[model samples]
Target: MKRTDIYPMPEFFERYINLTDDVELKDAFAISLQELKQLPLDKWEAIGDKVYAPDKWTIKDILQHMIDTERILTYRALCIARGENARLPAFDEESYARHTDASNRTLEDLIDELSLVRASSLAMFNSFTEEMLQRSGLSFRGSYSVLALGFIVTGHQRWHLNIIKERYEVLG
Candidate 1:
């Protein structure tokens, strides 16, 4: 589906929406998965706990945040596809990162968990029919379709990956 198909674009999600190219959802998902799998784990480990700026997310925190956001977006897509009308709540990434103990975990472990979470998301999104993918629901940012959420999930990852490359200087 086209990006314009995602009506009533939420102001906050504009960056993510703009990051996405016009493409089929399945193709978008596949491209995102391949990009994610290509991220160099050794580079991420080498970065260690370094943050580009004070109070910014570290490499581990960023990875955890991506995993968390993907799960939430996937769940939202599932709910909307199933015709649920309840407005989904928003999550605080900083609070989540503060509470998460990624320091104790290895980069390999985080990558493994992220891969599993992404696989589950892919399966869930793949199960939806075209009509279901077009279904809309309320979220913190007003109305969003399942297909739009899928794009958002993909774009969100791309945004962070760009940050990893530019800010963290970690190239895959």
Candidate 2:
């Protein structure tokens, strides 16, 4: 691991301070990337195809979602790291979801695209210095210091993974 200073945890983080291992954020990111990578294409088709409701997200849709979220956040992180002081743009996730047509796309196509997107984002993430992750980003949606949001990105996918296993997988 690269040696860099971790910004002081935000006051808002008290509720979540112990929820995750701060040391493992990078590791978790790596593991999620690996998990998504190791999932067999056919298995993605079978399990992912059945994961969502008729009009809801399929497994491919979930992958699309993960990639999309990463895309937006990564760009925001870049803008902040570049010394941009502009407010963050508000995003309508439901609108994006509707317009993406992810629901109708084949599971394989979405996964391939998602895999590519993840690779791109991971490369970006690896390059970030701790200071860059702590920079503040402003947006109509709200203010989020890069350091604070980093945890969200790390934990958010795991949150969804559990949902897929418990809710969508129909596990007892």
RMSD of candidates 1 onward, in order? 2.0, 4.1
Native-structure RMSD, model 2: 4.1
Candidate lDDT scores, in order, read 0.83, 0.63
Candidate that scores best on lDDT: 1
After the best TM-score superposition of candidate 2, give how far the Cα of residue 21 lies from its true spot, in angstroms.
4.2
TM-score of each: 0.91, 0.74
**Once superposed on the true structure, which residue ranges of model 2 sit more than 4 Å away at CA?**
1-21, 40-44, 47-55
**In model 1, where is the ten-residue run with the lowest total lDDT?**
1-10
Clashes per prediction? 0, 3
Q: Mind sharing the TM-score for model 2?
A: 0.74
Please give the lDDT score for candidate 1. Answer: 0.83
Candidate 1 C-alpha lDDT tens digits along 68-169? 999989989998999898898888888888999888888778878887887788888889998998888888868878888988998898899889989997
